[model samples]
Target chain A: MLGIDWNFAGCGCGVPQGKDVEVGMRGLLVKDFRFALQNKKMMVMLVVIEAVFLVMQGAGSASFVMGYMMMGCGMLVLATITTDEYNKSMAFLMTLPVRRADYALEKYVFSFLCNLVGFFLAVVPYCVLRPDRVADTLYLAVVIMAVMLMLQMVMLPAQLKYGGERGRMVLLGVFAGGVLMFTWGRKVWERALAGSEGLQEFAARMAEGIKGLDAAVAGIGAVLLCIVCFVISLSVSRRIMEKKEF
Target chain B: MLVKMENVEKRYGDFTLQCSLEVREGYITGLIGANGAGKSTAFKAILGLIHTDAGRVEVLGKNREDFTAADKEELGVVLAESSFNGMLTIKDTAAIMEALYRKFDKDYFYDKCARYGLPVEKPLKDFSTGMNAKFKLLAAMSHEARLLVLDEPTVGLDSVVRRELLDEMRRYMEKDGRAILISSHISSDLEGLCDDLYFIQDGRIQFHEDTDVILSDYAILKVNQKQYGEMDKQYIEYRMKEPFGYALLTKQKQFYLDNYPGIAVEKGNIDDVMLMMTRAEREKKL
Candidate 1:
């Protein structure tokens, strides 16, 4: 009987219940971290590349390093999922004490933690080389982090739903579609504006409106949007996991 | 009962598994069936690995669907076709187990690994099939789970290793609350280890009997055509047409022993029971 407290905090319904959930979550997190650690060679290679870029390009390469590391951190989550799913090992993993919901939550938490570390690690060159622009660098970094978080939100659910191989294909399709839409949308807007003064005036006003937007408010808006996406993605992932057969 | 599956049904494209079974506390229950006999399906249903099309699967007294993380903590499992990530070392697995289970016995795990010649630092991908099977079983038992749902836990191993694993299973059952629901193609293993047996044939539990009853009371009566025509058919659970004449499977061994002195009655084992229970109908005309 392992001295486990089987109380469930008096709630008998659904998963992610009681203190045991946290313990199981810790276990799940550790497993993923270990999985990530197994790619130590890749991690070191990335760091070496960033270091060379820093030495060659100096502080100008800070944002590049930041974006690179943030994405690398985010990719670790996918790698863990892929490893868990490798050779149908997800079936074996699900048999552990951790519930499916707990598994999803742990991935989300681990992703955020990894991205946080990436953020801090990536900003070191900027802090060292261009301390004067620290405030602006911090602001830009926050925005990039928000974008990275949204990417993560999209990624986690996709990986959970479609698994590793198909999930990557889906992600590629999504990015390609977004690029196409943006390109076609800009051409359509230009054509429409060229057709009328009234439309051009409206466009001018829209550009002015955008130019006048407050930085802090936009930052807050990005953060809020990331939060909303995070919530939605988390809910979707939980559903995918709960309904998953293995 | 630690696990109860009542008419639990699962359907693949062409295969449908309908099973009813129970694993009670302090007893080792063996599920004996040929390949594709729904043994794995039944275990998966009990573990909530797959969604059942109908009926109920209860584990540790809660419907499997309602098994919270805490509830699942009481279950240990080893799937026939899957195990831990191959990229992980045994040490990494041990660390993960220590985190995942409050009752995980790290010392016990290390001790077993040592005894079994498993290297702690080597990745699981480097291990042989027999080593992997041992590791999976050790991981399942490391958690001190009340119920173990094992599907072909002894599938790939030598006789000596298989014997050692079975011995470990017996040692695991020494605890008062522990129980196991194991399936194996090796009938000799189940016959010697299991408290009771369930014979599944094509997704249905065709026969269920205590292991003692199967070993002690069940018998296969070999008779010539003349003797077969004259012998009582009421006690025959299954009958197979042999090249010589007829091989009758009966639960009432004493009934035939008393009446048919001239007939040869062979003591029934799991392989005999499974062979007769699953394939006899197809082989026997009447």
Candidate 2:
């Protein structure tokens, strides 16, 4: 007969015990980072391609080139999340000691870290070669990071709510809708500006107003908007994960 | 109890899962059911992977909702499917597990991997189905958790590997306060390992008893039409009609053997019990 012990204690596996939320969060980050790092070959290929693009495009449009490269890095972050879902590994991940909230926190942290790496790789070289473009490159990097964050804000929740295949479909639909709206809005604006002197004058005034605004204040506002989006996206992703069946 | 589900309920469109069972420390509890019999659903509910409509789930003496990361550290879980990312090599997986689990025995994990003939440098995608299953089990066992929740952990492994895994489970249970809740369609695996068994059908538990009692007391009575008509209906748990006669399932095997002079009574295994019970449920509906 098998021995039956009702006691909860005395299971001496020599493992440490205690609930350290920081350690749990760190564990989740490490896991996600390791997962992202497994694509080192792909990252290297992207770096080689970016180097070619930088040399061909020249330093005149360095900020624009760097911003485009960072965008690809951001997409890699999304790809890692999608890959986890595609492999059905999220089920295993959730069973670990980490909470759903921690998983969301780790994704944002991982994405931010990847973006930082991309920024350094792209901007540092340009800054070293052309010191005059430091401020411009820095500003462009921030804007690119903000845009990437917003894109992830939309993608993460959709991916968490739906699986990979359907999630990609949803992302495609959003992108298509945005392109259609942009094209239609641009056409309307052109028609209105061509026909109406008052409307064109108002547009010119708006552009002037934007240019006249303090750069520091605008930067602060952009950072605040990104922070707000990050918080909301994390909350949405957490809720979706909590409700997920598998 | 290491794990407890009290009146747990989950509903998806028309199918409902309503189950309650307990797994005590230092014992192996087997959950036996046919495919799509809500066995997996019950396991998910206990793990809080799915929202339960009503009832409480308690693990390691605390409500599942209140379970902290520390509590989870003491749990080892293996789902029906491969859980590791296929893109990762075994070395990468070991790194992840070491980070995720504080007590993860890295050496033990690698040793098991080597013993199982799994290449550590290759990505998991290169592993065969049986290799993947063994890897998941190895990962779970490497954690030294107090409770192990395994769903179909031995599905794709050969007989030799399956027996080795079962031996490992027995060794795991030898530790005081260690328990396992395992669900599998393979009845023979559970027959030798489980201390208690729970038979689930539709959405509810049809039977929960000690494995010894199930094997010793439960039986199937083969009878002709006249004997079946005369046999007491109270003792028959489930009945299936065949062209020859009827196979009647009953818990009171000794009672029938003593009462009936020469009725064909054969010991019922887990499979026979599940089939007869499910058939009986369907027959009742008809």
Candidate 3:
């Protein structure tokens, strides 16, 4: 009578996936939070670590060094997750009436939650310690998210294909090497400017000009990048899983 | 019928498993095949664990791929390997499954655990292979499912445990509407429990018939080769003939029985049928 076709393909087996049928993310939210209920000890342990990290990074002024360390931790967690799914725990979960799409969505959303918690903790110290840099703290939040989102883009596909151990190793190596090279380039530029009187003044003027743009633009860019990566990853991973053999 | 696979075809690299099958309600159907013969692959496809390249799997008249959580709750599975998280105790796994499956039966879970002497407090990792299989069965049975899919459920269990598992499955079907699809290489179990048998070979269903029908229809006729040389090859599924004598499997056992009253018409089992079919299937390729 409601004209809702129980046989509707879009609802269960249709062009519009049933998993995407509603605004309600109860399924996603439930699984992301299931660890809290299923393993209370582990949840308590993670919460304690977050509080400790927040205290350590007070004034939330996270350095590039802090960013690198968090990325390493993220890589390690993703590795463990992928190994559990592929070699160890997958057969059991797959046998149940769980959908592949829901499974993939949980991985992406939960890992993002992990990064979100880490980023928030990193800035909480600065937000409370240095109220003046609250705005900077917020900006740091966006940048940390951008870096994590990019890492996810690399990890999800690799984990889905080759899986955890090797994928994380490659991602961490690539990221660390790339950042180190950039640091080397920056230090070389600093030495070049220090060696020349004219170049020093010119570099100072350029730096001032570059810093004038609104920090809000960085936030906007990071948010947009995250949205794009999340959407593309979800779609691509769905296709890969739909066609995957096991 | 509880489960039906129509013209199913699955190919993984060089391996292929093809068959059309149906499992009626109130009966246990044993999916018999050799190792690497695609029995597990077929069961996986039926459970929607692995997607078949072609064909449809229907459960309770609804296609398996179209199932929801509610639908899945009514269809239980006990894979060879336990699916419960290693860190979780029997209680922990039971609690999680209870939350996840709407029909999860708590009292039934405890009763079965107590009956089987499974330690609810023991971490699942500490259980032996036999104990693990029992717990998996307990979890599945707790669902009170209309259909149960078991993939080599008796793999590591001893003969006594294997019989106990089969007996439990049989008791579950006493309600007269439930069904089960059991895939195992153990032929004696098939003989003991299955109402119907499906023999798969080389990815194609070479033979599928009633258990009693096969038992009555086939016989190991021991006859002198000189006399058997003039017999019809069309009726012979297999004939191990030599200069001394011959042992043959004929579909028309009654015909041979009536014709050669003096010849031995020993009964063939589900295992003998499997051996003959798989052997003949391989000999065809050569």
Candidate 4:
């Protein structure tokens, strides 16, 4: 929410431009687009793959597919976080008028947006395909947020530690490992719960009990995770750059 | 105080950068150093972009640590590298800047951009490196930032563009309240632009003084074969090279000029003075 009031400062196209850091951001964005183009092949490939997965997930109703869609989207968004380094965006970002604080905030906001986009894209189509079980989509969204936050928390500190290319590599490696571990854990828990008929029946009867508990715990946990990850990211980045020979 | 650095030191394992620096309210300060001389590190410390281990920096009567958000708002800074977002247009960049500063003049930014022949619709990526460099300077200077911090703004520019940027900086300084700190490798620009300069070698401020004083102080004596023996050895800073004989670099140029009236003396430029002051540092490594 950049509260931009888009009234141009009276068009003076013929006159000399102004002095300020705001104009610098224009140049920065242009360079960002250029960098995207430079990696056009990979970017196009990623977009296409994401689209294909979303379409396939829309046709599937299995719980495993739902988990895959949510977590997959989270991973897509995670890659964007460090792609800027490949494009050398960090160097350009520093020269602009924007302060380091805002720069760090962008990562948090970006991660959140990516999770929302991924969840809505895959979940909405799935719900439309099967109007009867749309409630599952809500759980899917929650799962999306959790996965994105979890991945960001794991990858963020690495981004700060190595930076640019090396940082992204480490982040990806850790993220991949995390997704595997989390998926394994989720599968094992789901099987264990399903194996106990008594627990499944109890969960169904006490659905209300689980709802309140889930809301309270998940809400607080998400908030705490977001805050901690953000602060640690800011702290780690500040340390790497602080008195750095750069 | 306009700007002051006391007992500032940064360590890079093998080398150490230690110095004390001051900049008067109405003058431009130049930080000079050869490659790996810690000029960039010193600049970063002054901007508070990087935290320093030991020392204090004061700008515009506010200690570097105590300077509030309002104080930072008053300062306009541009470093060797950029600090802006990439996806935003030039127009969007300006809008973001407007929020950060109370003195941000939007009209001035567009006006300067149009004058520079920069395309507002085009992103910074479309521009050449030199064009991008100019845009960087434009962004920093557009804000009525009380203090301007520049790190080698002219390193990659052609002579003509460098001069244009230099003139803009000089115009900024027309207002006595605005101060500038420029760090550059090119000696000529600093020789003419800065009122005061600090020569840094191996991360230390080896010499600091007025340009005019240095100009008139260090004399490159062109002595005849006979007068080499009679010449004042104490005044000679040291030998430039074995075969070329010696050239004296001094703070007391007027003394030699006044006393050795007959001896040929040449003015020592920024590079010459830097070479003289850091000669020992260079030699010890060799």
Candidate 5:
């Protein structure tokens, strides 16, 4: 799915040839999807939560639903990594025709698909309810997707490093730490700017320099940054998988 | 050789495995050893599940580092304590295997599943220990792998199911260019199954011999202390102080029979060979 065509027939090779790396990765995705589906309670819970939000918030709930489902599905994919660890099955899975890199890459692809599914689920209902706001909803969905992807960039590696249960705690700690630092840093920035004319001029110039850029260029820059973050996250996860032993 | 390990070593605190072995095409090679004898460690090295601290491990004619995903498609592996995710149904496992292995035979897989009485819809966690073993074996074979590295695949299985699995392995070997490296604590299974056997103890290989040679040439000679002293020790390999007197292990069954007709010479099997190799003192002169 990530630039690898699923229709392998054109390659004129079958399992006997075993030349396709993508096929093994496809298998990993299927296994992960199967595991995700096994959590029927979570699936039902997502539906109920969406219905309740829609009823309570009306059309205003579209953004909330989008955020909730994206988080829900992304988390489900992340949890599959832990399921692979259960019964030491991760070792056995590694024995298959998939490389460590492919296994790591598959998680990212699966995560993106889960987020896409969540986006589609939220958008379809919102569009039906408020057809005139389709463009606005799409734009909001893109912004939310970017944020969710950035979160995954942090979360996936954390999950692989700390494991399933502990990884969640680690993610919480990181988020809490980031929030505290941001608040304190903002106060320090304002105080330093107030105390120094030089710093105030530098800060204004920095803001004027960013504001001078075209909106399209800024959007492209943000997208490029997100892609770079994703690639780095995938690399970190691959290293983790390579060093892991049964 | 389909799989080969030479002077391989894996150290875990006090236990370090220094082993060398090979699995040739068309041969079922048995890694015979007691628990913690490093059989699983050696298998893990060959399968690339764990890294070796030193020496070489080559599978499918390539060093593990050079072996790509395509190379792994030709090899199937079963670990001693792990299988497919327990949350999956047999059906789900089949689908995953089909995707993972290019040559996965779903029909043959389902046939084996039915033969082993495995319910396709049931979660693997719900399977009995023996059923799980059967499923693991079936999954490994269903892909038509050229080399199958199995670590204790028959554990938890009863005699009947064990025999059935052996027969399945036999059938698998009927095809040319296929081989299996299996480990187990059950001696009779290896005696009847492996073409050649490597006996390991305390992270080292004690002996490697043809299964037929172990069964035919090896013998355990029970003798009183006086008889033990008087009998020829030229063919003796190991000697243990039994309550009756001294129990001798020798590879020359005919030599003792010819020299002393009255001596008790019991034919050796895998168990006796392992028992002597691990517990009995080596006759250093031999």
Candidate 6:
């Protein structure tokens, strides 16, 4: 038995039978997860990079290493999109029984899972080495995850809209712009704060305000913002996919 | 109708594609066209890949705008390029497809791949062009789809593999109500496989006729200047001037054969009809 069921008993009109069976969003997530699993080399690379970061940074810099590793995982998520475009596999995917909305949803879920796993992997080493800092590490992980999600939210749609090469260039431009703004803004802030005692006092009060803020509320707000970004990004990607031609 | 496109329009800047066609149950419709004749665009519209500017597209009896994932499950598609991710092996692809498509038969897919000499463990990028083409067809066939839409499926395949693929298509049609819509630049492939052929040029369908009618009734008549000018042009669909004479294409071959016994009338294949119809000046009435 080769599992070749060539039964042609039904109306061969190609019309899907009564009440078209819809695969739920969960099925789409599973399919995307399976697709991601196929890239063994990328998974191995992610693990190796995280291990290297963990070892080099050591226990003292656990938060920094974890943040870097989580960000790395986020980059890997974007890589998957670029890889699909480069290989022109999106066309194949579009032909499948999955809707564009499902595809967009899958990307968001898959990328979130990947970043979560990366966060967990980073947390595991820190937990083993610096058990006392577990709570602090968890808080830092939430912040880092939020940042990663926001970055992904921006990058995903741009990649889907522009494709591999142009998308990478656009991502690079965004990164460069962020770095330039950070450096220039830091200098300007330092110059302003150095001359003005009032400004310095205000900055001190702002820092105190941030430190006094409720951690749980801040974490919840960050998560909510990430969710909002995810929804918006998913919608934009779906629209891009709808207009795309093979 | 299995698939229908009514006044489907897609425009990219100045290039506009306006097409209308149909694929009926148990029929194989061939869309024959030149390289950029909008065949792929029409396919994209039918599959709802690209948003059309205007017109209605219905697939499997449902308007394309309303087609759900389950509706798409009954339609198998193979594009001009190998759409498989290059990093994925056949095994991985089968897994992904099984997860995506509820009716996907993994064992049957593997069997078909094995029969086609496609290595199950190798990534698609490692496969040759012919192997990739065969693998795509095999994947499309493994799914028990009622409508199979193939675009340039046999382009890189050798004659033997092509014949085998065509035979497989014939076998696929054995189940009543199954239909296929295939597009190819190679007209000979369609000559033997297609039930009806639609000739497209410059984003418009020039003509559509049954393969039997095309083979039996259509012809290329070779005549000198004087004879071509003197002959009744009523039946001549198109005429192209050659170095030595004029090659005229007519739908009523028997009429020309009966009336002008001296004229050289050759039985028209899909290619001859496409060439003459595309390049020849259109008749005022048609």
Q: Pick the candidate with the highest DockQ.
A: 1
Docking class of 6: acceptable
Q: B135-249 in candidate 1: lDDT tens per residue?
A: 9999899888999888999988999999999999999999899899999989899999999988888889988889999999999999999999888899998888888898889
Better of 2 and 5 by DockQ: 5
What tens-digit string does per-residue lDDT give for candidate 3 at A1-246? 233232223223223235332211333344334433444555455446645665676534255534643564445336445534632566666555455555566677667766776676556655776688788666666666677778687678667755666766776787799899999999998899889999988988988976885766756766777777777776666556655555
| Clash pairs detected, candidate 3 | A9-A14, A58-A125, A59-A125, A59-A126, A60-A125, A60-A126, B18-B203
* Candidate 3 steric clashes: 7
Alpha-carbon deviation at B170 in model 4, angstroms: 1.0
Candidate 4 C-alpha lDDT tens digits along B28-136: 9999988888888787677665567788878778776554444555666666655443444576567556665567888988998887777777766677667777777
Off by over 4 Å in 1: A1-15, A195-199
Model 5 chain A: which ten-residue window has the lowest total lDDT? Answer: A7-16
Isolated chain A TM-score, each model:
0.87, 0.79, 0.61, 0.55, 0.86, 0.73
Provide C-alpha RMSD values for all models, in order. 4.0, 7.1, 6.0, 8.2, 4.0, 6.8
How is the predicted docking of candidate 4 categorized under the CAPRI scheme? incorrect
Measured with C-alpha atoms, the lDDT of residue A77 in candidate 6 is 64
- Candidate 2 yields a Cα-based lDDT of 0.81
Best-fitting candidate, scored by lDDT: 1
lDDT of 3 at B31: 83
- Residue-level lDDT of model 4, residues A51-120, one tens digit each, is 5665676545435555555555455433544554534555444434434433444455555655675566
Better of 2 and 4 by TM-score: 2
lDDT of 2 by residue, B1-286 (tens): 9999999999988889989999999989999888888998998887767778999899988888776667788999999873877888889888877877889999999998999999999988999989998898888889889999999999988899999999999998888999999998789999999999998888889889898988999998999999988878787888788787888889899999999978999997888888888887777621
Query: How much is the lDDT of residue A38 in candidate 2?
Result: 78
For model 2, the docking class works out as acceptable
The 0-to-1 C-alpha lDDT of every candidate, in the order given, reads 0.86, 0.81, 0.69, 0.65, 0.85, 0.80
TM-score of chain B of each: 0.97, 0.96, 0.92, 0.91, 0.97, 0.97
lDDT of 5: 0.85
Q: Arrange candidates by TM-score, highest first: which order?
A: 1, 5, 2, 6, 3, 4
Residues B1-286, candidate 5: write the lDDT tens digits: 8988999999999999999999998999999888888888888888888878999888877777777777888987888888899999999999998888879999999998998889999999999999999999999999889998899999999999999999999999999999999998888988899999998888988889999999999999999988987988988998887899877899999999999998999999888877877777443323
Q: What ranking emerges by lDDT with the best candidate at the front?
A: 1, 5, 2, 6, 3, 4
